[model samples]
Target: MSISRFAALALLALPLAACQPNVPQESMTDPQDATEADIARWYIGTIPDDPFDIPQVDTNLLPEEMVRQTVKYNGSEQAGTIVVDIDSRHLYLVQNNGTAVRYGIGVGKQGFSWKGAARVGRKGVWPNWSPTSTMVRIKPDLPRHVKGGLDNPLGARALYLYNGNVDTLFRIHGTNEPWSIGQAVSSGCIRMLNQDVLDLYQRVEVGAPVIVKRTGKRVVANAE
Candidate 1:
């Protein structure tokens, strides 16, 4: 998003925050007091004065950094520096000839597994979760739309997919169900640990191509 949008969100939220009773006086600022840096952070909901340092985890909650030593292979290692082996459920970031830094991944369940090449068309931090019309049709009571937060099924980052110029609505993103790693479990989205997604976000630029080769294709999507 543009810096203006970030500034607008910050300006919007800070006022709501300052309006709450018991907030310190110094925290309050004039309309002119908003700064570019403040806007960037609060827009991202990553305020400097956040209270929590070490995060707390619940049993039902998946730790964002969970790592599994599972096998994974995909032409991702060849996808202009990244490859995701869906069968083995691993994501690879190429560093050199025939070598890459790999991370275990979670995948779509059985019928939901997708195969084909696409590009990272969009990226979002702390993305919101809005079940598709199909998702709601499958389960009527499911929340139609939800904002971003720890409770969101999508974790800290998201990489939206596209076929040429057409949006697929599928994404490579963080998941709350880390236990689903190495398994097909999503409606169609590719999932990874939050730490892994964050790692990828830093490494991949928008428009990077992702080759999601079919299962059992020795050319890509290897279990090892």
Candidate 2:
């Protein structure tokens, strides 16, 4: 080929190369060697201003998909609605901008799972816990009243769900067991990471609608 022809081909290839996606650089540093400060850099960092000291989460324990992030939402639900997909183990807080803040969640196991709509009747910070009569019957040793703290089953925040004027006796709350964030092990309540629950608690308001669906459609992650 002539030199002029070769130059034209090279220019064509340059545009194609520029259009290629830029891949993120992989870290060579070992996660096991990560320091406390390094771990604190996680999106879900320790919350210092909280009434009780919230510790930084060790992200290694959580699956990458379980990490909180904003994702594309295709549902018709209005902004401020909470949609929990029990099958996908995901909770989406709908936004007005065609996106939703997604969080990993733990749902009830087996016979404990239920599906329906409810409203956030109340919000609590470091709330006290009282086992239901049914809960007491199942676990007779369970304390009727437990003061709220780090040791409490409801970690840092709780959003009490209500059906009309009646309390559903179920909740979406932070869990003392962070590792259970993506599992199906809770008795009936939806469990979230303490940091995530704190974030959710702030964005949501009393009387916000919540839909819990067993086989709901999963939200697709935004490619951009």
Candidate 3:
């Protein structure tokens, strides 16, 4: 190898490195052993610290594990894939690197639970809430339509799921009930804290792949 060739290779590598998103690794901390400062720094790194937003999540209402954290993902899914583990009540957005941004999520109750592969068919920021006919029939008091905003059951964001061209009538959305996170509380939708959902909405685009699993499925690279 010549010095000139090595120098040329180094120069080429510099531009490639610069093109990558600057995802900080130092702030990554284990949720179990993290300090208050560690949690604060990690949270700030994962999402914007917007205190005055109308739909901001109440950190006081969130459990520690529910706070967004970037973790080592041993999964096979490529970057931008969204994996929802129903049993764990966590949604992971696979990153370009070998890691994932995990958010605490709320899944549907027993009979309402489902598992399948779908795509993010649509995205809504403070999207409107419309009770499905089935929901309206089951709960006569439910509203048919509600405008989007802080008070809406959809909260800050919603990602509508679709299997090819068919609407699944399911969503990965923000919830007004933050306390319901990490629980099986939704009629069918997968819910997140408002802030987390907003962050996720920003990262994902329409047509992104989504996998909802009932069991803890291992996503190995070769098998993916």
lDDT of 2: 0.74
Backbone clash count for every predicted candidate, in the order shown:
10, 0, 1
Better of 2 and 3 by TM-score: 2
Candidate 2 C-alpha lDDT tens digits along 155-176? 7899999999899999999875
In candidate 2, the residue pairs with backbone N, CA or C atoms under 3 Å apart (3 or more residues apart, or in different chains) clash, namely none
Estimate TM-scores for all models: 0.64, 0.76, 0.71
Model 1: per-residue lDDT, tens digit, 1-224?
A: 33234334444544343333331122312224544433322221222211211111121222222243333333334534556666766666655444556666777776777878788898988888899888888889887776765456677789988898898988888754444655666787888766567768878898887766447432333434
Per-model lDDT: 0.58, 0.74, 0.70
> Whole-model lDDT for model 1 versus the true structure?
0.58
- Model 3 CA lDDT for position 54: 34
Top lDDT model:
2
Worst 10 residues of 2 by lDDT: 2-11
Q: How far is candidate 3 from the true structure (C-alpha RMSD, Å)?
A: 15.9
Model 3 spans > 4 angstroms off: 1-52, 216-224
- CA deviation > 4 Å runs, candidate 1: 1-79, 216-224
Q: Which has the higher lDDT value, candidate number 1 or candidate number 2?
A: 2
**TM-score of candidate 1 relative to the true fold:** 0.64
